[model samples]
Target: MTKKVCLILAVVLMSQASRACDDNKEEELAIQQSDEYFARAYGFTPETWNTLYHKPSSSLQDALDVSPYEGRTLFKRPQSSNNSFKKYFNRDQEDHENHGRFAFAGLGANIVNTGLFNNRYTPANTWRPLITLAKRIPISVNPNFNNPLGSFDPCNSNGGESGICTSGSVCSLFGGRPSGPCDQGQVCCINVINSCGSIVTLNNTYWQTPPTALRSPCTLTVRMDPKFIEQKNNPICQIRLDFVSFTTSQPTAGTCTDTFQVGGVSNEVPTICGDNRGQHMYLHVPLSSNNPTDVQLLFNFASGTTISRSWNIKIAMLPCGATYLAPIDCLQYFTSTRGRVSSFNWQDVAGARQLNNQNYNICFRTELISSQKATRMCMSVCSATDGDAFSITTPPAVLLVASANTGFASAVTTDAMEAAQNSAVGATYTDQSRANGITVATCLYDYLLIPGGRDANNVEADRYCGNKLNPSPGSVKFQNVCTNLFQQRVFISGTDTNVQVCTPIRPFKLTYQTDGQETAVDAVPATNTIQALADVSNTGFCLEFQEN
Candidate 1:
């Protein structure tokens, strides 16, 4: 404003007769005094301001004083002062609604790309929440709660670990410790949940063992907030628990001493105990739950036992219809086409022991998206060099006797003493050892089922148990190495030398089931407390699959 405008206000209300004329003369005089110096005070207006707003309202001669401007001011142009707020931040225009980055984030929905490809492809996953995100978010609010802002940034830490990316104030608000730096002036907040009975809502949250040793049961609850659920555009389908480091009291004879189990899931997860490092599980989540779902991971330690225990499990929430999503009902899913698959409690401590009463399918990735093609897949046991690697209680060969000399008859002898004398089938042994391979007997209980397994010549195969997964039903002479290399493969469709490891058809899956009745040495009985076979505690199957 010019000094003329300031001086004109001083002469207000002179006399009714000369007031009008006096005011006009005084305003003109004031403009002449300071108009040249302060006229340029408006300065050069930038394009952004010009597009969103108008110029200063008038040229020099119109007024002697200026009116003030405000944010969200209800005053409009032409009606109120020239500098009154427009539609930018003022929002005084009743017809306008909310629309911006900050506004859409609170609405919680997947962005719909109607024009171009979505996931960076020619035609990406064009899955959108509703008809359009813009229509739903404007002037809308979540019915459950208002404050739905949360931080679930999985790509936040080193070594594949994860943390939440949010402001320090939000970190403190959620009782999280601000760690590394994040984009947009935010911090990588990590919420280390060590206490039992604590709820886990953030994806990639870590559940670690308590600092001080306590025999009490530890439990971590999981549930999604409505805001988070909607933002994902689908309900939680599976919860993957990655055991980065896990060690507890090993199972005692098929039963776990210190158990780790999950509840409130649609599918079943085995209760296991032992050293299971670098293993993961895909827990099935229930469909609906009044909006948010609830799942619990529970651990129990048996009392009156001296055993070391520790665990660091990373929890991941997978929404429905997501990329790299595992098949439903699969207990474990291996994404990489080339990786080893281990049992829940299977460890290398005491030779190798398979957990009893385990019934779950382990899936391998067969179909790759985004131009990745892989049709042929194969799984092989530890290897021929490691003789002790294959042990699943396969029945004895009916043709080969303790010695190759006695042929054309059941290798198993009637007298237990006589069988041991010839190293024949049904021979009792103290230590863990392979029994016999390629037997005609059916494997009813405690066996690994590799559906449609075959040998080099495509000979049909069946359930494999009792020691080795021999490729063919050849005599004991062929059991050694140099047995055709082509036979030792379990294919995406077929093939395996000995120890039976198979799958569940398409998508390439293997089912490992163990009935309560294990191989009983005393006549191989199904039920009752019969003596367990000498190979009761033997190395479980350790097979590797490759995608080609």
Candidate 2:
């Protein structure tokens, strides 16, 4: 190749650029992102092709000794990439994302016969034959542009659906329509076989509750095909399941009548039953595994079921070290800084009863990456106190506030006790703790662990468990409705009536804990919270959270 042809070849290679976006995420992961990442590789730039032609080495050197500097071979590096392709792929993952890396020699003298850039456009062809000597292949790799498997590789997003990133000719071969543009003259394909049993290999897929009632044991297994280890370069590190619309039979006491289990993961996801709509969970993928493990979403309905089930769950796959990845130990993760978190099956999910034996952390994002800053979080019972919306008291469904005398760690059932029985305070009293401010420790069986929680007086009341938001003679029912002017109101019949809003500045974290036993207690116990009721079936709390 002559010097003039080299200039023309460099222009052609530069012109080969595809449309790309600067942002990796536009909104929630459900929204199909048009992010096209392009990375300029450091290998075989035009100046590095000088001395490799005359002397093809008996053993390959780190990089082609084209010149001392100016340009360097990409396969090896002056920046210490060693000889392993694994480090190169990890360092520049965006290069092999929706867009594959650009590998070319621009113009080379006798480089074709030396067997590196044999063809004008397919330089990686010669590199393919050399990898077979290894006993085991890498988990993921850069799909050579000329490889036939690239034709069916279901990668990238297209028109709000998971798409196979492939060339136009190859897309047509599989009867897939070219929905959108991908990098490197390829198209995002939208017509692949997607069903419950079929292994989903793409990102951003949707799995809804089966329309038919008979479709029990419905499983949608999301796993990267381990067979094509050479083509998949980006490993999905985390899988976020957005319960866009999830509903099923409520749990019986604490046990699930119908079950939705997450399987094939190394970690154990707690089996949950009942209404989980508007909720999300993060399932992590172990990166060190030679073959990427599968994460299965299984929904098994009880035989001869009566409740109508409907769900629309969106599966979003995130690459390793993605921004949206939740903490490794977190089972349920929320990216939105502000939202309401109702306990499983609260508010009519079994007649508004709290699921028993519950223990899990409800995590919220406090990062400054979003449009809103989660600097401080203010939580109150969901503004819905009309009926039994915010009723997770230890004693069945009622709270008794002493109009006269109330002390810390004392029974708060009052209103003459007869009037409390006549009123809708139920036939029993709830978990009572005049355990005010930071000394709030009367609650043990079921309570929200809010670190640095404070009362309206701005005192450190870091824990809350009794009847209302703070210590108040507020659970008194007036005209058959529990109304507390001293606390924040639910839409009951309601707004915060407190003179001052309590502590809202703490590390945003809350753990909802419910003990295994729900047996009724005749009197308040010195340990494990207080409960005085004929039936101790307490309703779970409904909390509303805000980030800004």
Candidate 3:
């Protein structure tokens, strides 16, 4: 019985092995078929190969264990190499690209008829240019479109109508007339929006223009708050009364203030008013008042024609009480020699202040028509020589400890002034401390007088101590160098003239000897050449005698 059983077991094992061999052959054929199908469709084998089979082993890994099932590994597919697989795929891609290039070249050559064409077969073309660019780019985009001004939403939705709203309007989805509007003489309009998030319209014009006669200047009252003045340098406000072309002076009772004479010749003229030439006028008012005040405006014109207009202005107060005060005395320098105030304005908010508390915040303006020259008076000072150079220098005070108890003694005037006014006002008070000398005149050149004598004919060149030479050809030319000394004591003798330095005196004063002279006029130093003296007046100097 045991022998019979062993024979049967051998036969069964042999049959099972044969069946396993047949199954392995079938799986190999299936893998080959799959590979053939993938190559025909996509030009490369499929990425993964899988088959389902039954195994007597308890786990899939046990069935796949190559150590136990050596020969049964079966139906081996070719393993792929990095280069070989890449080259195989790349060849198909190259073939597709070549097909496209061939088609493009065939079409282009047919159209243009140039020879040896790969693409774009024009006579001058060598190779096709490859195009490269992004179809879309990243950018910053503002997509909000609710407000026309492109600002925050113009809506106010507070519980109270007047609380957050500029005027007495509510932000209602059902837009209609607002209830409880502002009082009479005021209009409600929306000026700002609040957090509650609704549309708000407020009422009220900040200020209104009053009616006045044409061609005449009228004073308008303004209501200003003291808080406003605290915030501005000059608490003053400017306004425009009207535009006038001409004006005349009002006649004085007796001799109309005889035209302010030079040699006692009654030279008075009538004051006229009004012009249609369309010039602008300005008036200034102080806006520091807590209450409103009436502004008094004086109107004068050249012609009888009248003009009426209004001006608008904005006002704000400076941060500190210490405001920038313009030196009124310095303004005198800018006045025209012809004797009229030119139209100039200042908008430095840091320096404005209330005029007298009487003038309100109303815009101040006047008709600025160009006026004719005013007659000037001649004051004669006999035999007053004119060669002294005016000089000014400041030095930083040295600190000294006189007593152990006290800090530095109260600073001197120059020290105090410089400490108060630094470069904030653009004044070089500190730099003046390091300078050495005061002004001493080298040669006489009169800035106050008109051109005179032979010296006026001198040809000015870059001289060391003398003024920057201005080229004067005819009578203003200099035959020889007045003085070739190089020093810091040069004088500005005339408004349009320059400095002249020398050792020995010319035949006469450069004004009289070089330029030409009259009995009354001579060259005098008007300003310090070392300091900033560009803005000096020619008004106060006198003329002793007149010559033709």
Candidate 4:
């Protein structure tokens, strides 16, 4: 029995020791699992853990535990690779050292640990292990505030007619009607106020309607609001009164009486009021009224009660000189010169073919129509025969005749013939005679026709001469003398002439015919048919005449 008892005791002692060993193994596994969880949550590696903890592990178990989840770490890693959690740990440790308190670390650790304990036995609580202490750090919150404009009530809903105040939140005036419980930051204005104890401003919509009309012997008064006036920087502002429309019974001027008064002082009224009905008439009146003052408009029909008058007026306050840039009464420049007329006649040989001599004479005389000034003139000639060219000349006999026509004492210089040249139907030639700078308007011109050339082909005669001459058949067609004579005149700057520029003020052309002892002006080669071509080449003259 003694032997059996000893053996039993030995067995019991061994069993107790084995059970103790098993408990130790389970506790070791729990600790290892907890470390793995932290490594996964905070991206801790054995290298990093050693660096942060400042100590090496007893075995490679802590380091080896980090290998199973090399790339599969769940938490975000710190930017630094050497020690991932060192900064966070150091921050917490600093707080504790500085304030003698655990700061966030103690609280976060307790919450995470408690959560882990509660969910430890259950695999269903996947989030428990993932819960991190760092997430417990406080986050700030911000909220938006309101603005002034949003606080006001909408205009239409507050008690006004619907269509008039359709969509705006701000109150406004419409055609002399008031409406709105205006939105914030906007003021309400009235349409028309007879007595303005304060300055009255008409909203934009009020101008849409036509102004009211007042008749003769009637008075209209308006008083400005003092508050509105004071807000303007200029204490002395001007009021612009527009007479939009006016009508009077009488058509004569000075028959109707209408007047305007500002601050009890009568002002000058518009003259010729009846003539400008329906036209815009603006009046500016200066106002120095610090208090509410009357703007009175009075009409007196005392002269004639039968003379009835009516006018539509619009009023606005503006800074001085606002409408001072009024319309100007401008004078027009004189387009033509005033002068007397002078004429002379010449009889010349007419032949179907070229004349026997190479040239024939045509003559004209000029007399001063006005005060003597340098003048520019041009002349053209036309004849039935083509190639009947003419040139101006100062042969002694022709010059003698011209000198007699001018009535000048000494023999006039033949300088007038300088501009003369053989005529071409579509070509322009200037009078070179005026080159010597003749200030006297009186002069004479002589042209010699050299008739050796052949006739110019009549191209589409009907279009040119207003006559159709049949080329064949017994076409006993009478020649229209009017078609034979084409004359043109050119005038350079009249009294104020610029010879260098040679500005042609008025240049015209005419056609004439001599038949049955009668001379009649004919319209041909129409006006502006010949234009002074500008010499862009800048060669001879500033301008030269050319046929278009």
Candidate 5:
């Protein structure tokens, strides 16, 4: 052949060889892509694929590189004799069920290659073998299982139009509505009545004036209302008095022009007259048959130019048999009905008016209902009396002062009772001193509360007497017994027809115990009285007093 003919023949042979090589490469690429799809879809490694294909043992890398579908390609004609397709389908079903029922449905379509690209064998569209992979396989087994909006059905569970009830909106559970806004330790009732855990207040008001007579005294009466008596089923209940206002023109001692007396008929004796102008008065008076009346304010203004006097009173009723856990201060009951009275002037016998600085005189009485003992009594005189002209002329009463070794009935004179008398006279009386007096009286009088008489042969009489007359240091019962002297004089003055001397008493603090295991210190009004009752069974309930 010539050079030109040889060049043309070489180009044609090279072109034919190149075409054959390209077709072989395309076929290999197709086989690789098909192997990869089956490995992933059927959850098999190269080793497992070899075993399923009945191929000889080989290295992992060699088996992966050599496609199982190279000789038996996916594009080849189907064979009924080879049941390997069924095995792949079975394995796919097992994997689908293991992961979840819906996880491998799309995987099944890819492996079977039934629909798209069943006849396509071109290498340009390699992804055509996995067309169903892009068709969207569900991430979860149940399509509606994880839809956030579809998970909760609030309307069905809560009797409402929406899943969550609106604020302040009513909701029903088990066919019942919720109720609230109840008080502490209380529950709201369906009947809509606020009857549980309530505190009730009962109050009444009255006004009175004293008469102008010398022997006959004026009176202000207080009794339980008919309605209250009917409800409580008793004549007497717990009560306190408020001396809202007391105004007297001339409250002087000698002139008897403006004298006043105050006490419970059965529980307390009448107090000596002192200047009570603008002075608040509080009295805890229990009205029983013995003291059938609550209180009496006797006035004797026989000499002053202005004999006018008037008073306003308010009474508070508490529940009967109610236990008071806190200390009750009777003096606090004295509301600011009027201002304080600082001074007054009394006309002398020579007709010359004398300026006398006025001071307060208050009295108090307490009865121990259970102990049946002599009442635990306390008295205080605020502004000192002008003792320069006043004197107790009556013979001193005799009292049995007992000692550990020998008990003697001696005459305890009010004349020598200078502590309370001088304290009141000098206007130097203090709340501390008054408290000391109460402590002594309660201790001493408690000893005198014998069953039969004031004799030494009584049971434990010596011990009781010794404890009262002689007390240890810093003890409540160690104070002087001057309160008894003051009480004697007040009693004498109240009953004495020849003299009408009124001693001045002031408000003082008192310590008392309540039923609830608490010790309370409160100021008791000089005009009021105190009463304590011992428990009958000698239980811890003993030593409780009624608060005014």
Candidate 6:
């Protein structure tokens, strides 16, 4: 082929241009049917004609020697890619994410017999095979669906319309009309399912304060506004309380005896609401008041049948220095009003306080919700004495001392007690001092709970010895005695098996069975049975079984 024709062919092959943003390169080509480049050069580019005619073996040297346009063949095309077509196709993942690479020369040339024929070909004819291969096979490409004219996703205060793509189950924009927003009073709820299988319900709604449950009248008074009685029947507005009981696999004693005190001197009685029920229900306080004019509701959950209910109206606090004789016990009850007492003032014993002139209202709450149910006996509220005002003395401060010997020993003692309680055969508790670097001090006060007396005993045992066992005074006949001390009440038995002897724990009264099998006192029998022993000094004593 002539040099001019070779140059023209090279220019035409290089005319192909890649489109903007389009990786596939293809451009129109000028096919010269009568041009010397095609007519004289075997109707093909110089290299193609040379390769077809000579069929070179090695470095194209033999073809160059035989070719008339050897020197012009030196014009190079863009570097052909080394990666195979299959390799490029393999890069695609199932998720449609990939960076593919392709080689056209090897596969394209082999398919169409590219170098075997010499023809007057245009750029399209030269690259037609490669284009066909690419078009025939599908490409996994991501398509953009975003709309530039408007916001694609609609959202409401409620979490319903949240994600970009909607499942139709969720509210979303479909036709032309927009989806409505969330309603008032109710805030949006975020549905978050966490890894631990907990569904967290998040809401914008909030309350000024959390509601409190009233187990007793005292609890109701302490937690609620004294005037909260007005909201008695309001369903959503009313405070709700409940009681529940169930029989377990075995007839087990409850954690608490369900007993509470009334006046300072009276023995604590089992709450009525707890009768035949394992759990007790009472009042719920949604609001509370600070003014003295308000009257708080007192509900006694007596035996499941009888509920001793009353109203204790509070009197305003008086000036701190005000003088007056005590309100007499003879005038305790009020003459008029809804079976309510007239004007009455609670004394210091009823946890009363003298109002300070600077403070307009006196505020106090029940220590425990259960305390609100029972009425507290008050001291005489008397008018000021002519000469001097009476002053009640306060109890001294209690100081807890901690030393190396006591601190270390207390922990050891607690663990030992826990271990003994957990054993099949209760552990024999001896007050022997164990030395592990230091002597530990275990307060006997908490180890055992005394149920018989009015005062709760919290005395620590003498450091020298463990604890001494004392019996209940009520168990004895005739003779009157003050078994108010810790020794005379409840005592820690062998281990976890705590036994109430003569004076059985109030709410958990012993069902004495005369039948030999169900007797209160029994020897080591077979399975599923327990026994107790009673004495004048100590009632409800237990013999803990020892493991073999």
Question: Which candidate number would show the highest TM-score if scored against the true structure?
Answer: 1
TM-score of each: 0.58, 0.56, 0.19, 0.23, 0.24, 0.16
After TM-score superposition, the amount by which residue 94's alpha carbon in candidate 5 deviates from its true location, in angstroms, is: 99
TM-score of 3: 0.19
In order of TM-score, best first, we have 1, 2, 5, 4, 3, 6
Worst 10 residues of 6 by lDDT: 356-365
**lDDT score of residue 163 within candidate 3:** 12
lDDT of each: 0.49, 0.46, 0.22, 0.26, 0.27, 0.20
- Which candidate wins on lDDT? 1
lDDT of 1 by residue, 1-548 (tens): 57865454343222223333344444333223222211221111112111112223343332233222100111111222222112112332321221121222223331221111121111243453443643554322221111223323444544334666555645654456777775455677776777676766666678888887664678888865333322232346668888989988866666777889888888878887788888888787765644455788889999878877888998877544333345665788665547777666654444446676788988654534344446555666655353345455433322223323433323332212211111111212221113552222224455666666654456434455555554343323223212322222110111223433333245566777765533444433465323433334444567767665
Clash count per candidate = 23, 10, 89, 8, 20, 47
**Cα RMSD (angstroms) for every candidate in the order listed:** 22.0, 15.1, 39.4, 39.6, 40.7, 37.1
For model 1, what is the C-alpha lDDT against the true structure?
0.49
What overall lDDT, based on C-alpha atoms, would model 2 receive against the true structure? 0.46
lDDT of 4 by residue, 204-260 (tens): 111111234333345544433322211122221334454454544332211223332
Model 5 CA deviation exceeding 4 Å by range: 1-202, 208-217, 225-238, 251-256, 269-297, 322-548
Q: Which of the predicted structures, 2 or 4, would earn the higher lDDT when compared with the native?
A: 2
Off by over 4 Å in 3: 1-215, 223-303, 306-548
Tens digits of lDDT, candidate 6, 1-548: 59976775464334322122222121011112112212231112222222212222334454355432111122212222332133222333521121112224432222222221112112243443344453444222112101011111212322232211122211111111223332221112221111111111011111111133324423212111222111111111111111222111111121122232112111112222112221211121222233222212223332343332222111111111111101111111111101111111112132211110110110011111132211221111133332111111110111112343334212111312222222111111222222432211121111222233121232221111012222211111111123333111112322222121222121111111011111123324574233222111111111111100
lDDT per residue for candidate 5 within 1-548, as digits (tens), equals 59976775576455445444354454344334334432342233333222212243244455356432221111221222232123223445643343212223543342223222211122343454344553553222121111111111111112211111111111121111323322122111111111111111112223334233223345443443312211122233434443445555532222234555555532232232323333334344453433244444445555536444565444433322212100123222211111111112211122112112212222122212343322222211122232122111111122334443443333243333322121111101122322353321122111211111112222121111111111111111122244433322121111111111111112212211112211122334683433221111010001111212
Tell me the lDDT of candidate 6.
0.20
Worst window of 10 by summed lDDT in candidate 3 = 354-363
Model 4 residue runs over 4 Å out of place are 1-175, 178-216, 224-236, 251-253, 257-272, 278-293, 302-309, 320-548
- lDDT per residue as tens, model 2, 1-548: 58866776564444323201211221222122212210011011111121111112222363344322111222111131222223223334444342333223211211111121122112333344332322232222222222323433335454455555665744553445778776456787764432345345555456665445447677776765322322244455667776767788876665676888888665456677777876677676765435557777888888767888877776766554233344555566554545677776666432436665666666654534264334566677665544344444332222333333232222333322332212121222333323431112234556666666655656444444444454222352333333342221111101113211234543356777766554544333565444433223446767776666
The TM-score obtained by model 6 is: 0.16
